[model samples]
Target: MSGDPADEQLVRQAQGGSRAAFDMLVLKYQRRVERLLSRSVRDPADVADLCQETFLAAYRALPGFRGESAFYTWLYRIAVNIAKRHRARQRPLESLEDGEGTFGTDAAPSDDATPEALLANRQLVRGLDEAVQALAEDQRRALLLREVDGLSYDEIADLMDCPPGTVRSRIFRARESLSARLRPLLEGRGGRRW
Candidate 1:
């Protein structure tokens, strides 16, 4: 109950046994929660299931939720934990689909852009995706939560259950690893630094 005032009101109502208020909260954050889940869970079906489970857990725990952090931050913790448990139950030998890149390109090429530029953009995006996927789980998660999600190190540390220094170290190592992996692809672009 510590996010937007609207959310706080809704949480309070939900805590007082207002189902509609809780549904409103779900509608507000459903897409964001799904997007977060998609970063870790490859299967859309599984992501949807985990998202439902996240909200369900939240609703059940709403009465005990103190206004210590933002509502989204609290919900994110639940989602992350659910995704981790799901991953743990998955088989290690399961094969992943090729070209299923989770990370997106930095910029989309305009329609007026040259074909060559578009091709280069695609290559860069692919390289980034592969490089990110190659990183250790902790590094990858930390990097995405920082860069893509734009979360503070403190927030990430809370979600990750680590010290802020550890989160910083993980993101640094992730960036270094990605830079090394993508250097060759980027070198062809007039020696631009990644």
Candidate 2:
């Protein structure tokens, strides 16, 4: 068993059909799954239901879960997929006419959003953009390429003419700088740490 008994060992036991082990996994990750779902699900009741569905789906698929990826990574992917499906079922609000022409939905907004909430969101986005802009050129490019462009670290390294390790370091540093700048704005907001 791994030194962290609650992780690998519980997964192994759960795979062997131990209900208690499976229940333990659910208990450990319930809060995290709910928090993740809350990002795309506005209703508290809906978030709770989705969390249950996610765990149920994970349980059914447990037999096929190879040990290739960490258990949490596998579970996280399942939760995100469930949340995406839940969001897709919600009706979209009116389409924007800004040439971009994208549809909006209540799923993307908090259920209790007021004018103040909208302003706070806009301010947060502006603050993040400013933080990104304040980064060094190389760091900014590396971060954006990885995040906004969704490029692999190796791909980013090739484009930036740097080693993959260097790209990773640059991205980490950039995130640290941005996090430092945004910490105060996010403090006491009950947001996820990462």
TM-score of 1: 0.82
Clashes of 1: 0
Question: Per-residue lDDT for 112-150 in model 2, tens only?
Answer: 889887777666665676676578968976887677557
TM-score of each: 0.82, 0.52
Q: Which residue runs of candidate 2 sit more than 4 Å off their true CA positions?
A: 1-5, 93-194
Best by TM-score: 1
| C-alpha lDDT values of all predictions | 0.86, 0.74
- How many angstroms is residue 108 displaced in model 1 relative to the true structure, after the best TM-score fit? 6.3
Alpha carbon lDDT at 193, candidate 2: 44
Predicted candidate 1 versus true structure: per-residue lDDT over 42-138, tens digit per residue: 7889999999999999999999999787888899989989998998999753223544557655466687989898888888888888788789989
